[model samples]
Target: MIRVYRIPFSTNVERVALAAAHKGVEIEWVDVDPADRSPVREVSGQDLVPVLVADEEVVFDSPRVLAWLDERHPDPPLWPRDVARRAEARVFVEWFNRVWKGRPNEMEAELRKDEPDEARLQALGRQMVAWLDLFEELLDGRDYLLGDFGVADVVAFPFLKYGRLGLPEGDDELFHRILVHWQPIGEGHERLAAWVERVDALPRA
Candidate 1:
């Protein structure tokens, strides 16, 4: 059986769980708190959730986990088969991980309650809006980033959740718009939304 070390609320862990479900791959979910980092370090030599231990092979990193799962079970493909489209999907996933994950300011207000600086919060809001604007441009008329709900969508969903929860406390209007935009995109697709719901409903381990 595949064992996955994860945290329920983590988007990164959620993506792996969702992909495993889509592939009809059963996983032994191991719940871990981000704060209690020692368990992970003891097992994998690094503190990270969404660690996949299968058949004595340890796979860390969400993207690598997805790729390993795909290779092991190729049906209901998470990545595009066409070369160009596959490259596009990979690019989006990379950008989503790198660029989208850098919006620490979105969570700054909550993280720093003792010294709430208005200027810093406002700057974070503006920066978040700029990033959302970029998403708007990228998602102009597409259902998914690469015209299909693939790995990119799974990777992007968690960050979107963070934006919805974090940014609203700082800038309500911007958060509302982003949430609205994302709702339809996520809801419009049957498989994608169903996958999300399945993961959301799963019994945490």
Candidate 2:
């Protein structure tokens, strides 16, 4: 059995779990806290969660983990088969990891601030909205990022889900609009939603 070192609330870990589930791969979950870096470093010689350990192979980083899983279990493909579509999926995954790092901090400020500083909150909201608009433009008239559910969708969904839950409290309309854009590609889509449910049902490690 494959062993997955993970943090339950991490979007990165969720990406790997979702992909594994999508590929019908069962993984032994190993929970590790961010503060407890020793166990992770001991396993993979690095301090990152979502490390996948198989016989003689250790994969760190969520994207690499997803790719590793896809390569090992090719059935129910996580990536688009078309070359161009695959490239697009990779592009979105990169953007999510690199460009969206500030989202969580911004969201935290927006949600937890006692006085709700309008300037900071609006700036964060605008930044997120810009990304949302970009996603809308990319997803215009399409059901998923690459016109089919794939790795990009799985990688991107967790951030959106986290943002909805953590940020912009009392903004139902905003969240609803975001969900409307996300739902068809996320919860409303059978394959993707099933993957989500499977991940959700997993025992916390």
Candidate 3:
């Protein structure tokens, strides 16, 4: 059987697991501590969660894993057959990676420390709202990001779900206040709101 090494409740892991379920690809899930490296490290030669092992070949990184899944199981294809549309979808995937990776970095730094920076937090909140606005405009009348359900939607769904949940930074009043700054995207942007619902209704692993 194919094997996947990942941590529970991890967004990236969840994304891949969800994609696998969508493709109806059965896998043996291996839950591992991110801090400790032994077997997964030995297999994938990396410390990252979501390493995919299939027989003699080991695939690391989420995007590559997703692409491999699409290639290995082409049914219920996650990408379009048209070359131009496939390119566009890949471009959007790259943009989403940057947004997801950079969005919470500074906020997470302050959150891990004793003293949180109020001004920085406010700026981050504003930036997140701007992101929501961009997506809202892009999804104005579309059911999915790439005109149809595909890998792009899979990559975007987990983060958008967080936004729907107000991008909770912590369990406190300030976090809720920060959350409120952008939580209205769900109600304000009709298409994106519906997109969230559509993705939320999908089966998961």
Candidate 4:
């Protein structure tokens, strides 16, 4: 059996869990306290949850874990079958993790200020809309990223959950507040709105 150490409400941790579930891979989840990551450190030499321990091998990082799972359990693969599409999916995931994922932090900082910068906030809003527009273009005719439910969707879904479509159940209020500045899903992003609805119904581990 596979064992995973994770903390609740962590999008990164949820990424691994969702990918595992989509691949029909069963996992033994060990929830860890955010204040105390010693349990996670003991196995991975780092205080990071979403660490996967399997076959006496341990792996950290959500993207790496997803790759490891795909390599170990190829059935219902988490990546697209086509080599080119698979490469594109990896690029999308990398860009999302490195770039767009950090935008929320910047937005939240401005939002939490006593006197928020309206002009800067608007700029951030425009940037977010631009990013969403890219996703809208990507989903031109496809249901999920790359035309199938794969790792790209698994990674992007958790962050996109806090969109301005009003809070879904269990969404972080602060995150929703920060992310809501972008264009609403219902307004111009019809495909993304539908994609969110479609992916929200998928299974998670």
Candidate 5:
């Protein structure tokens, strides 16, 4: 069986877990202490959570693990079958990771200042809403981001779910404020909220 070293609640780790679950791929989940990463280093020479040790092949990084799962399992594909759609999925993941995902944290930091920049906060909030609007538009007349639940859903869910469902109890207060600022996944954006539920309802293998 494959073993995954991870900090269980982490979004990245959750991505791998969701992908594995979607594929019904059995995994030995080795929960790791975030404070001490010696085990991860020993296995994959990195401090990142979600290092997958499989068949003597060590794969770290959430995206790589996702790819490995798809390659090894193949059944119920995690990516779109059409070539163009596959490219679109990858592009969405890239933009989410590199561009959209961290805006909340940035907003939180700005909020912490003694004199928060109202103009800047408003700007960031608008930018955040624009992305949410894009997500809402993308979901128009479709079940998932790309017609079916696949890579884009797997990558986007862990973060977007919070906008609608709100964070779990004991989640960071600052992050809670951040989500409140955007409120991207609720009544106004019914499609995105529904999509979150769809992904949330998937079997947790």
Candidate 6:
């Protein structure tokens, strides 16, 4: 059986888990404490949730794990089959990852705080929307990020979950407070909004 070492509420872990589900791959999830990641470290040589253990081998990194799963289960491929489109998808994934480098830290601080900084949230939201704007423009009349429901969508979907419309369907005050900075792009970003609904409705792992 495939094993995934992950803690709850991790974007990195969510990326891998969602991809596995989308590809119809079953995973034995091992939840570890975020403060103490010894279990994953023993296998991955580093403390990272989303470590994939399969075929007597251990893999780290969400992108690497996702690609490996795609190869291991090709029926519902996570990447495009057309060589050029596949390359294009890889480029976009890399770009998104690169631009999103420091966003998690900022987002975590903002969302987890008892009293989120309105100014900070506003600035963070603006920056995020700018990035989303690029995607909005790119997604003009398309169903998914790369014209299909694939890895690119899976990788970026977790971050968008904190938005008002996408915040986990729960009753946590922090989740509600985080919504302060999150404004729905509904008609302004029509295509992306539709895509959000589609991705949110996908079966999760």
Q: Compute the lDDT of residue 95 as modeled in candidate 3.
A: 84
How do all the candidates rank in terms of TM-score, highest first? 5, 4, 3, 6, 1, 2
Give candidate 5 regions above 4 Å deviation: 108-121, 173-181
TM-score against truth, every candidate: 0.71, 0.70, 0.83, 0.87, 0.88, 0.81
lDDT of 1 by residue, 49-133 (tens): 7789988799899999999988998988989999998898888887777765554525443335876676765565556555655
**TM-score (C-alpha, index-matched) for candidate 3:** 0.83
Top candidate when judged by lDDT against the true structure: 5
After TM-score superposition, the amount by which residue 165's alpha carbon in candidate 5 deviates from its true location, in angstroms, is: 1.1
What are the per-residue Cα lDDT tens digits for candidate 4 across 1-205? 9999988777788898788888889999998988899899999999977899998899999899999999999989888889898889889988998888767778788889999898987887788878888888889988986787888889998777657345556655686666664646667778888888888788888
Task: Sum up the clashes in candidate 6.
Answer: 0
Instruction: Name the top TM-score candidate.
Output: 5
Better of 1 and 4 by lDDT: 4
How do these models rank on lDDT, best leading?
A: 5, 4, 6, 3, 2, 1
Per-residue lDDT of candidate 3, residues 128-198 (tens digit) = 77777777777867788778788888887876665565544543343333444444655677777778888
Kindly report which residue stretches of model 4 are placed more than 4 angstroms away from their true locations once superposed.
109-119, 164-176, 180-183
Q: What lDDT tens digits, residue by residue, belong to model 2 across residues 1-205?
A: 8999886466678787777777778989987866788889998998988889999999998889889988989988988888887787778778787776465455565556677676776665567655655655555566665676678777876666543343334434443343333334333234444443433454322
State each model's C-alpha RMSD to the native: 6.3, 6.7, 3.6, 2.4, 2.3, 3.6
Better of 1 and 2 by lDDT: 2
Alpha-carbon error at 106 in model 6, in Å?
A: 5.8
Error of 5 at 93 (Å): 1.4
**TM-score, cand. 5 vs. native:** 0.88
Model 6, 1-205: lDDT tens digits are 9999987777788898789889888899998987898888888899877899987888888899988888889978889999999999999889778765355457667767899787886777677666667778878878888888898899877766555364454434443334334535666777777777788888877
Write out the backbone clash pairs for model 4.
Answer: none
